[model samples]
Target: MAERELDPTVGALRGEDVEDRDWERVQPRRISDADWKRFEGYAAEILRAMGMPLDTPGTAKTPGRFLSALFDSTEGYEGDAKLVTAFPTECRGGPDCEISQVVEGPIPFYSLCEHHAFPFFGHAFIGYVAHEHIIGISKLTRLVRMFARRFTVQERMGSEITNALSRILQAHGVALYLEAVHLCTQMRGVRESEQTTRTTFWRGNYEATPALREEFLAIAGAHTNGHRS
Candidate 1:
């Protein structure tokens, strides 16, 4: 049987923030049964073509599951960053309050390694200095999910998360660190006994001042040597 770690599935996408745009408008209107059958058959063929053993019990459902997982992983295209921006957290001074604040996150995330489409899973630690606004803590994780659920390489994911904070929070500074393991590499290919991948993006004040940057890195357990804990 195919084994999965069974991490928490994001519960039904609730909250008024979720948009109801009809995705069907952009997708194919129809696929005939014959066509569907051919397409479905292509699933197994794809793995077989990739040199994956289909006869293995662990892979029996992989063809069907892969198709489902592929679509689900790339669903970020449907999200609007503006949705969260619309209701920017109100400050006592009404989003004009500036404060140097750190939002540390041990937030869990999941994504597909672009090179393999196998799972990459782990946590992100984010810290930012808010300017005129304090975002809901939940939104920080949402931001991480927003950026992760898109087509991106690991380096891009790290930078995009920090970039989003700078743009939305109008932050004075932001620091984001991503530590995730790509199962495609670890379990399928040349397995390394240590070290997965670590990517970080420090922007604005985080980049301009060494002390400020070090403070954030210290919190993330990152070393000046470009290594992470």
Candidate 2:
């Protein structure tokens, strides 16, 4: 598979050369039905070893259900072909061109942490300044869910969304903010239930202009605080 290029500005924010990693290797591969059956059996055995009452009426199907849910939750690995499609911008160019930021926010998403396999869920806010093309509004939600369904860290997921949008739209700028409550953090280790993780990524013009970044953040932050309250 061909490697996708990460946006340089966003990559820099990550503090590493993102091109070093082969993203395709981390995506989900097709699993045969036989393989699934074998996996189910292994899961059952593991649950039994863990002292789970597999023979009980309620627990007998728990292994199968668990595997099914996991498969569904990580469906982002399948990839979305429609993500790259764009529409002609409404704004006409020249001196009369009125360029502005398009923002979509509070897009709910859920994902499993790669390390703990525990759920992290919350809202995403995306903003981009269009160039010659603009994407459909609903595509933003799909984009968020696509990345969110993968088994990954919060920071990486935000970067993926930011970079993908920047590449697809070739936008003048791209901005993304993610706020989530991670079960891995709340349900284990120190077990701080009140904790939540927030991540932001800015690229192109958004990075160059502090006003634009702050505007996006203000809109996203207002909606987030209001939604939670």
Q: Estimated TM-score per prediction? A: 0.68, 0.83
Worst 10 contiguous positions by lDDT, candidate 1:
1-10
Task: Report the lDDT tens digits of candidate 2 across residue range 1-229.
Answer: 1122233222233335354223323455688999989999999999999999898999999988989999999988877655556676654654333237888878999999999899999999998888766777688888888888879999989988887777667678899999998888787667645777899999888888888898899999999989999
Please give the CA lDDT of all the candidate structures.
0.64, 0.79
| lDDT tens readout by residue for model 1, 72-99 | 7876555643334413344444323433
Best by TM-score: 2
Local error of candidate 1 at 207, Å?
1.0
TM-score of candidate 1 versus the correct structure, residues matched by position = 0.68
RMSD from true fold, candidate 2? 5.4
